[model samples]
Target: MCGIVAATAQRDVAPLLIAGLKALEYRGYDSAGLAVLQEGEIRRVREKGKVREMESQYLADPFPGGTGIAHTRWATHGVPNKVNAHPHIAGHVALVHNGIIENYASLRSELESRGHAFTSETDTEVMAALIGERLASGKSLLDAVSSVVHELEGAYAIAVISDKEPGRVIGARRGAPLLVGVGIGENFLGSDAQALIQVTNRMIYLEEHDVVEITRDRVRIFGQHGEAVERTIHESELSTDAVERGEYRHYMQKEIFEQPRAVADTLEARIGPHGVLPNIFGVNGDELLGKTKGLHIIACGTSYHAGLVAKYWIEDYARLPVNVEVASEYRYREAVVPDGTLFVAISQSGETADTLAAMRESRRRGYLGTLAICNVPESSVVREADLKLMTRAGPEIGVASTKAFTTQLAALGLLALQLARHRGLDDARYADLTAQLQSLPKKIEKALELEPQIVDLAEHLIHRQHALFLGRGAQYPVAMEGALKLKEISYIHAEAYAAGELKHGPLALVDEDMPVIAVAPNGPLLDKLKSNLQEVRARGGELLVFADGAASMDGNAARGSILRIDGGGDFIAPAVFTVPMQLLAYHVAVLRGTDVDQPRNLAKSVTVE
Candidate 1:
C-alpha cells in the first residue's frame, strides 16, 4: 500500500506534508517523494529510500509552497528507485497515486501515440500524462482529473496539483480509500486519517468514484455520475499516542504486549453476568444468528488464519458447519453457495482489496447476509456489511499483526457464543464459556510473563534458516499463524502442519538444523501431539515447545527447550498460546537485525489485488 498526503493551506506546507508521510511510515514503503506548486512552477523531489532521507533533502533545500502533495510509494508497477518514485510530472500536472491501473498499458500506448513521452515505468505516470493532456486542452484541474479517471479501469486514490491553479488540490478515489481533512484556513487530502492526524482530525471519507476539490477556503465533491454531492465529516478516534512506540523497541513488539488490553476492549460490554450479550454484534444480530444455518468465512493473510480458527469454534460450540476460504481464491472460482449460510469477512484494516472484493461479490451469490469483523469502523468492509463486530484493537501499526489477531479471536469467540445460544446451549455451559472469556485478560497478562523465557528461546532461532510448527485441533491454525509471524518478520522459511500429518511428507525434511515448534495445550490431542514430538526427536530435530503449565514434557529438556504458558485451558488456550509465538518472532527478528515492524516488500493494508 502506498500513502498520500496533500494540502492547500494559507502558509507554506512542505513541513506539514513531510510530517504526514512520517506518520504513515508504518504502512510500508520503498520510496518517498513530494511535489509543490512553488515560485509559479511545480517543483518535485523524490528519493528511493525512507521518508527520512527525503526529509533530509527537503531540509537542505526546501520546496516551500502553499499547495503540495506527498507520497510514500510501495513499488507495484516498477522497482523501488528514484526514477520510479511518485509525484510523477508531465506538462503542468503533478500527481501521486495508490492502487493499480488495469488498463495502463493500453493507455500508455495511446498516450505515446499522442506525442506524450513517459519518464517512469508506472501506471501513475500514465494518469499524470492523461490529465496533463486534458489540461493542455484548456480544461480546469478538476475537470481534467475527472475526465481522465473515466478512462482508468482499476482501483486508485489520486491527488493532483496543477501550476495553472495556484492554491488547489484535486483528489479522487475509485476502489481504494481516500479522505479529506477539514481544517480552518486549510484543506487536506490523505490516504487515511493517520496521515493527516497531525494537522486535522475532522475527515470526510469519500465514496467509491467520488471526486473532491479543495482549496484554503472551499471544498466541493462530485458523485460518481458527475453530480455535486455532500459527505459527512466525522472526528477521527485515533490519537497521536496510540501510534507511538513508547517503551518498546518496535511497533510489532508494542502490539504484541498490548494484546491483553486489546482483547479486553474487544470483549468489553459483549460479555455480561450471564453470558455473551445478544445484541453485541448489531441491532438485528440475534435474528440473523437465528436464521443462519451455516457460515462462509472469507479473509486474507492473518485474517484468513483467524477464520480457520473460527471454523473449529463454531462447529464445536455452535454445532454449525463452516467453510473457510482465502478471499483471493474465493472470488475467482465457482463456489457452491449453501442456502441460509451467512457470509463473514474478517480484516484488520478492512480495506484489504481481495477480501473487500469477495464480500462485494458475495451479494450476487445468495448468502443470507454479510458480517464484517474488523478493527477500523470507517473501513469499506464495515460500511458495506449488513452486520459488524468491531475488534477494538486501536491502531495496529505493525505490518505483521499481533493485537489485531488476538482481538479478532476475541470478537469471533463472542460470535460463537452468540450463535450457540440459538442452538439450545445450556445456561451452565454458557456461563462456563463466559467466565473463561471474562478471565481471558488476566490469563493474557499471565502469558506475557513468559516473555523473558521466550526471549531466551528466541536465541536458538536467530541463526536458523527454517522452522516447523505443530499443533492439533484448533491450535493448528494458531500454529499456522505462528509460522506466518516468524517467516514474515524474521525472513525464516517456516511451515506448519497438523501433528498427525507429520508422517505424511513433512517428516522427511526434519533434521538437526530444522527447529520444530509445537503448541501443546492440555487437551484431548495432547498425548497424540506428544507422540508426534517423539517422531521429531527421533529424527534429531530440535524441539521448541510452548506448552501449558499442566501439559508437562518431562523428559525432553535436552532436545531443545520448553516455555510453559500459564493458565491456558480449552477454548481460550489458542489465544493464550499465541502470545509466546508473537514474542518469539519479535525477539528473533530483533536479534537477527531485521526490520521487525515494516518488513521488506510487505504493506500493512493491501489495497491492490
Candidate 2:
C-alpha cells in the first residue's frame, strides 16, 4: 500500500502535505518524499524511512510552496531508497503515484527509444517521464494527464504538479482510490479522506478512469471519454479522535479495546423490537437471496479468515453451499463459477487489490450479483459492488487488524441471518438469534475484561519460539486467526489445526518447549477438544486452554495453564474468543519488544497485488 496527497492552497501547502502524509502513515510505507512547485522549478525531498525523518528534514530546511504533492511509498517494482521513493521528477513534471503499472516494461522501452532518460528503477518514474514528455509537446497539464492516462494500464491513483502549470494539481484514478478535498481558497487530493479530514471534510470520490484538475479555487473532473463530469462532494463523519490512541500503548491495543463500541456501533439501528431489519444490507435482502442459489466468499489475509468463519455460519443457518477462497489465488486460477452464485468480497479497506480484482473477475464470469462487505463507505469495492454492507468499524489504524476483523464477522452474521430468514427460519429461532446479536456488544465488553489475565498468561508463552493452536467446528477458524495474530506481530512460528488433524501430522512437532493453545468453547465438540488437549499433553507439550468458565478440565502437570473466558454463545463465540487471542499476541509482542502496531514487512492495506 502507498499514500498520496497533493494540495494547491492560498498559504504554505508543504506543511499541509506533510501533515496529510503523517495521517496516511498507518497505510504503511518504507520511504517518503514530496515535491513542491516554487520559482519556475519543482523542488523535491526524499527520505528512506517513516514520514518523521522527512518531517525532520523539512523542519531543518523547509521546502516552502503553495502547491505540491507528497507520497509514502511501499516498494513494488524496485528497492526502497531515496531514488526509488515517490514525487518522481522528470523535466518539469513532478508526480506521486499509488498502484502498479503492469505495462511499465514496454512503456519504458518505448520511452527510452524516444530519448527519455530514466533515473530511478520505479514504474512510477516511468509515468512521470511519460507525463513530462507529453507536457514537453506543448500540451497543458490537464490535457497531458488526460492523454497519458488513456495509454497506461493497470491500477493507479496519481497526482501531478508542474512548474509549467503553476497554481494547479492534476489527479487521476483507475482501480485504486483517489479523492478531491474541497476547501475554501484551496483544493486538495488524497488517497483517502482521513489525510484531508483535518483540513476539510468535504470529499469528491473520483470514479474509475476519471481525471481531475484542481486549482486554488476550481476543481474539474474529466471522464475517460474526455467529457466534463460532476462528482458529488460528501461530508466525512470521521473525527480526529478515531485516529488517536488516547490512553492505549498502540493503535492495535486501542483497537482491541475498542471492539465493544465498534461491534455495538455496527449493530446499531439494524436490530430492534422487530427481527433483523430488512434492507439492512444496501440491497433488498429478500430479493437478493431469493435468486441466489449458492455463495462464494473471496478475500485475503484477516478478511479471508473472517470468510472462513462465515462459511460455517451461512452453511449451517442458511443451508446454502458456500465456498471461501483466498482472493490472491482465486483470481489466478481458472476456478468454477456456479450459476446463480452470489459473490461476496470482504475487506476492511475496500481498496484491497486482490479482493477487488477477484470481484471484477467474478463479474466477468457472470455471477448473479456482487456484494462488498467492507468498512469504508466510498471505497472502490463498495462503489463497484451490486450490494454493499458497510462494516462500521471506523478507521482501523493498526497494520495487524483487530476491531476490523470482529466487525466484519458481525456484518457477515447479519448477512447470514438475512439469508436464513429468507429460507424460512422459525420465529423462535430468529428471536433467539436476534436477542443474542443485540447482547453481543456487552458480551464483547465482558471478553475485554480478560485482558489482564491474558497478559499474565502471555508471560508463560513469551519465550515461545513455536506454538500450536487447536479448535473444533466453528472455533477452528478462530484458532487460525489466533495463530495468524501470533505470527504476524510477535514473530513466533505458529500453526493451527483442527483438533482431529493433530494425530494426522502436527502432533509430531509438539514438545515441552512448544506451547499448544486450544480454543475449547462449550459445544458438541468439547469432548473431542479435551481429548485433543490430552494428546498434546501426552506428547509433552505445554498447553494453554481458553475454555468456557463452566467447561471443566482436569489440571495435570502440563494442563494447569487454563485461560477461563466465556464463549458468548455458539453463534457469537468466534467474535468473543478473538479478544483473548488478540490480547495474548499483543502482550507477547510487547514482551518481545516488537513493533505491535506497524509490524515488520507488512502494510496496513494491500492496495497493490
Candidate 3:
C-alpha cells in the first residue's frame, strides 16, 4: 500500500500536504516525501522515515509553493529507504504514485538505451522519467501523461506536476484508489478519503482511464480522447470521529467494542421486513445460485481465515464441495476446478496484491463467475467480480484488523444461507441457523463484556519467545486469526495448529514457558479438542481456553484458565468467539508496549506483489 496527496491553490500548500500525509499514515509509513513548485523550478524534500521525520526536515528550508504532491510508501520494487522513496522526478516533471508497473523492466531497459539515467530503485521512477522524456520532446503535460500511461502494463494512480505549467497538475488512475477534493479556492488529490476529509468532504472518485486536470480554482476531468466527462461527487457518510479513538487508549480497542454495530450494518440490507434473506443482486445471483457446481474461496491473511469458516458453512448447509486457498499461493498450483465453479475472493482493503492476482488468474481459467466480499465500495476487487457485497465496518484504521474480520464472517454466513436455499436445503434446519445469525449481534455484545478478564490476563501476559494456538472445526480458523493478531502487533512467535496436529510436530515446542491459547468452543469437535488441550498440559504448557457455558465444561472447569464466550452453537459461535480473541490480542500488544494501530513493517493495503 502507498499513500498519495496533492494540493493546488493560490497560496502555499505544503502545510496541507503534511496534514494529509499524517491522515493517510495508516495506509503506509515506511518512507515519505513532498514536492512543490518553486520560482519556475521544482523543489523536493524527502526522508527515509515516518511522516514526522520528513515534516521535521521540510520545516527547516520549507519549499514555498502554491502547488505540491506528497507520498508515504509501503515499498514493493525496492527496499524501504530515502533513496527508494516516491516523488521521483526528472527536471520539472515530478510524479507521486500508488500501485505497481508490471512492464517496468522492459521499459527501464528501453529508457537506458535512449541515454537516460535513473537514480532510485523503483518502478515509479521509470514512470516519472518516461513522462519527463515525453514532455521534453515538445509535448504538453496532458499528452505526455496519456502517452506514457498507454505504454505501462499494470495498475497505478499517478499525480504529475510540471514547472513549465507552473499552476497546474495532472492525475490519472487505472486500478487503484484516487480522489479529487473540491475546496473554496483550492483542490486536493488523495489515495484515501482520510487524506482530504478535513479539507473538504465533497470529493470526486476517479474510475479507470479517468484523467483529471487540476488548477488553482478549477478541476477538469476527461476521457482517453480528450472528451470532457462529468464527475460524480458524494458526501462522505463516515463521521470524522469514526476514525478517532474515543475514550479508548487505541483505535484497535475502540473498533473491538464497535463489533455489534458493525455486524448489524452488514445484516441490515440482507434481512427483509418479513425476516427473510433478500436477494443480493436482482438477476446476476440467479445465474450464480442455479449454475454453481462447487465453490472456491481465496484470500490472504485475516481474510483467509474468514474463507476457512465459509468452507465449513457452504459444505454443511448446501452440500457443495468447497476448497479454501491462500490467495498468494492459489494459482501457482495447477488444481482442477469443476465446470460451473464459483470462485469467491475475500478482502477488506480490496487492493490486496495476491488476492487481486489470484482473482485475475481465476477469471482467465474460465470459472463460471467470480465473486468478492469486501469492505470498501467500488474497489478493484468489487469492479472485477460478477457479484459484490460490501462489509459496513466503516473505516478500519488499525493495521492489525479487528472489525473487518467479524464483518467478513457475517457477510459470508449470509452467502452460505442463500446458497443453501437455492440448493433446496432451507428447511427447519436452515431457519434455525438464520435465527442464530439474527442473535449474533447480541452474542457479540455479550462477548464484548469480557474485556475486564481479558485485560486481567493481559497484565499477567506471558512474554513467551514462542506460543501456540489450538482449536478444531470452525474454531480452527478462529485460532489462526488469534495467533495472527498476536504475532502481527505483539511480535511474539505464535503458530496456529489444528489441535489434533499437536502430537505430530508442535508438541515438541510446548513447554512451561510456552502459553497455548485454545479456542475450544462447544461443537461436535469439543471432546476431541479438549483431549488435545490435555496433551499440551501434559507437556507443561500453560492452558487458556474459551469455552461455551451451555456445553459440558466438566473437565476444563478445573484447568489452567477459562475465558468463556459461553453460548451459541456451531453455526454462529465462531463470530461470537472472534470478538474476545481480538480483545485479547489488543490487550497483549498494549502490555508489550507496541504500536497497536500502525504495526511495524505493515500497511493497510497491499497494492503490489
| Best candidate, lDDT | 1
Model 1 clash tally? 0
Model 1 TM-score on a 0 to 1 scale: 0.99
TM-score of each: 0.99, 0.98, 0.94
Tens digit of per-residue lDDT, candidate 2, span 1-609: 799999999898998999999999888899999988887778889999999998888788876889999999999989989999988999999999999999999999999998888999999989999889989999999999999988888999999999998999999999889999999999999998889998999999999899999999999999989899999999999888789889999999999988989998898888786567878776565688778888999999899989999999988888899999999999999878788899999999999999999998987888889999999998889989999888899999989999999999999988888888888787888877777777788988998898888888899878889999998988899999999999999999999999999999998998879889999888888888888888888888888898987687775336548877777678888888988999999999999999888888889889888
RMSD of each: 0.9, 1.3, 2.3
Residue lDDT tens for model 3, 359-424: 989977888898889997757788788888888999998888888999999999888888887888
lDDT of the candidates, in the order given: 0.93, 0.90, 0.86
Better of 1 and 2 by lDDT: 1
Model 1: lowest-lDDT 10 consecutive positions: 563-572
Where model 2 places Cα greater than 4 Å from the true spot, the runs are 556-560
**Local error of candidate 1 at residue 324 (angstroms):** 0.7
lDDT-best of 2 and 3: 2
Name the 10 consecutive residues with the lowest summed lDDT in model 3.
273-282
State the lDDT at 506 in candidate 2: 92
lDDT of 2: 0.90
